[model samples]
Target: MNRVEEPLLSVSERRIATRLCVDAPLGAGQTVGLAPQQAHYLRTVLRLSTGADLALFNGRDGEWRARIDALGKGWASLAVIDQRRAQQPEPDVWLVFAPIKRARLDFLVEKACELGAARLLPVFTQNTDVSRVNCERLRANCREAAEQCERLSVPEVAEPTGLRDLLADWPADRHLLVAAESGHAPPVAEALARAREQAGGRAGVPASAAPWAVLVGPEGGFTEAELDALSKLPFVTAAGLGPRVLRADTAGIALLACWQAWLGDGDARPPFRG
Candidate 1:
């Protein structure tokens, strides 16, 4: 009979590592509490014992070294040993996409976190299929992804907003990049270069000045009127993602990777020198 080896830790271990490695300042004898789900994960799933090590972070706090204190029905606790690593912020990129079905939407959240998006914005367009959002679930997904990806901060998942509302009150100085289905649009690389140029000068730039947002429409894409309205905005630059017609989630993630490759921190700190 073949034996299956148990993972050294559970997927939830990522959360522990994130806390210790990405967010909290640890010291020997410090402690952290785990929520119900986390407790269950350690006890039931991973079968971790007391005295095992776990990691932890709190966004503001630096990473810390923690050890499992105890495991219970729906809760577990950890004692912080020492500081591991300091916190470092990612790019100022934001992902604004239309909500799709539940499964795909969940996938989008996970991928967005992995892609280094600082924030996730859900926009409702005329052609959009999903109207409501489960903010709590998406937030949980972001937390898990952050833990696994070694992200210092979890991306902010904003409440769903109407597309028109988003545009009308849009920040004038912020750059908005819209992914259009038309192949006529400029490539993402070019758009990033242009956005930086439009942004201008280092002195006036906000630390968050990268203040950029990428919009991926619904599966069917933007309605003609919606596209026209988006295009008319001077701050908006529509970019093409090559030939194929991508589903809403796929297009959103693809554009994120492309944008990151060009204008994001993932690149050699390209376009803008700091």
Candidate 2:
């Protein structure tokens, strides 16, 4: 387990090659260290050198451009030069879904991150097909998606919780958008449009709506009793993704996309987009 202890960057100037989302605080003159895996990626994989520059963001201070002060086998440090973008408000939408297979779960988490979901929650329903959820994998997928999508913050991954318990302890003000298949639910856009109108188009952190969450059941779908229970919640609004049946991953992404377009940050443009 020997670690490299050499400097990765030379004194010469270079443009940023990539952006990394780290857990360290970002600031000017701050020397942030990279995790072992990240160091390995830059050293052995990317083969970046001592003079290279890269962007760093911690979902806190803001995005910074940093120079590679040093890098080794399992260690790397960057000297934060300046902030490229100030932290801005983002949508507070949460994606609460049942765990599907590994591949689909990976896709779901990635798409959820790209779609601006503030949180990633996995819930176990009575008809759920999977018992165990790999939260670490979901986190990895989320991290990569955030970096690639130019998002300032990575969605928080929550531990797996039972549907009943989750519902019982749910936040009072947060509205839950349940994706219904065979119910009297309105279309996803139609439902969110109504809620947006009711909220009077505030256009704040999450556009003009209150806190919201999109829930998609397992592939087998929710049991009749579970659906009935969710429908009864005062904060729950069952929304349909049309007549065709969608896979759990598809439904979650589709519903969240519609929600963002309607009530979330639909009007806000990406900071990086020119």
Candidate 3:
């Protein structure tokens, strides 16, 4: 983390790449389209050819630098070669767990998109034991963990709904933390300072946006009538990330790393620059 932050990063053991390898503003004539196992992990396990470079993201387009334009007989292409680091602003968090089994539900969607969680929502609780998941293989492992964790944006995984219709249409301005095992909650920094005192200062609408959804319960949890209808939700809180009892994928990455260590931006943000 010195040497002036190593000029962001690069590394490339011929696609062994680093810093999510290639941040946006590219260079050699642009074009990048891959998938089909990342064009077979770049033409048969990183043996790339036809101009190889590859590293792009379109979750609101940010990181780039591409090449390999067209390698026939099954597909492999790229071009866009510039723009490296310009898409930032992603902390409208949301995780909403409850879908275990199968490699901890792909390590809880790769640690909730590597702990930035802009949306994942896969709840089907009532002590859920897998009601059906594999949402396109967890959306291709959240798009290979947002292109190896440099993430411009790619969390939005929803569509499992029904923890009583996601708390009977709960959206009283987002902020639903809920990691309750009911050993008398409230301790993730006083439930995020009482959700910024119920967001009474209005910063980003939808009720002064901040702490948004982590709610992980299952592996025999949450069902005293779904913790009394999520304790009569007034935008539910009930935190608690201590005293052992985690196991719905380690309480969904310990409630997304304690809500990214107290209302994420994961310590001045970096992993998933969007």
Give the clash count for each candidate. 17, 10, 20
Model 3 stretches with alpha carbons more than 4 Å out? 1-55, 58-68, 100-126, 129-136, 141-151, 156-175, 178-200, 205-210, 214-222, 225-274
Best by TM-score: 2
Prediction 3 TM-score vs. true: 0.38
Which consecutive 10 residues in model 3 have the weakest lDDT in total?
12-21
In model 2, where is the ten-residue run with the lowest total lDDT? 1-10
lDDT of 3 at 188: 76
- Overall lDDT per candidate, in order of appearance: 0.74, 0.85, 0.69
Would you list the rank order by TM-score, best first? 2, 1, 3
Score residue 89 of candidate 3 by CA lDDT. 73
Candidate 1 ranges beyond 4 A from true positions: 1-29, 196-209, 267-274
Give the TM-scores of the predictions, in the order they appear. 0.82, 0.91, 0.38
Give the alpha carbon lDDT tens digit for every residue of 166-231 in model 3: 888877877687887665887877877555555652333322255478788878888887788888
Q: What lDDT, from 0 to 1, does candidate 3 have?
A: 0.69
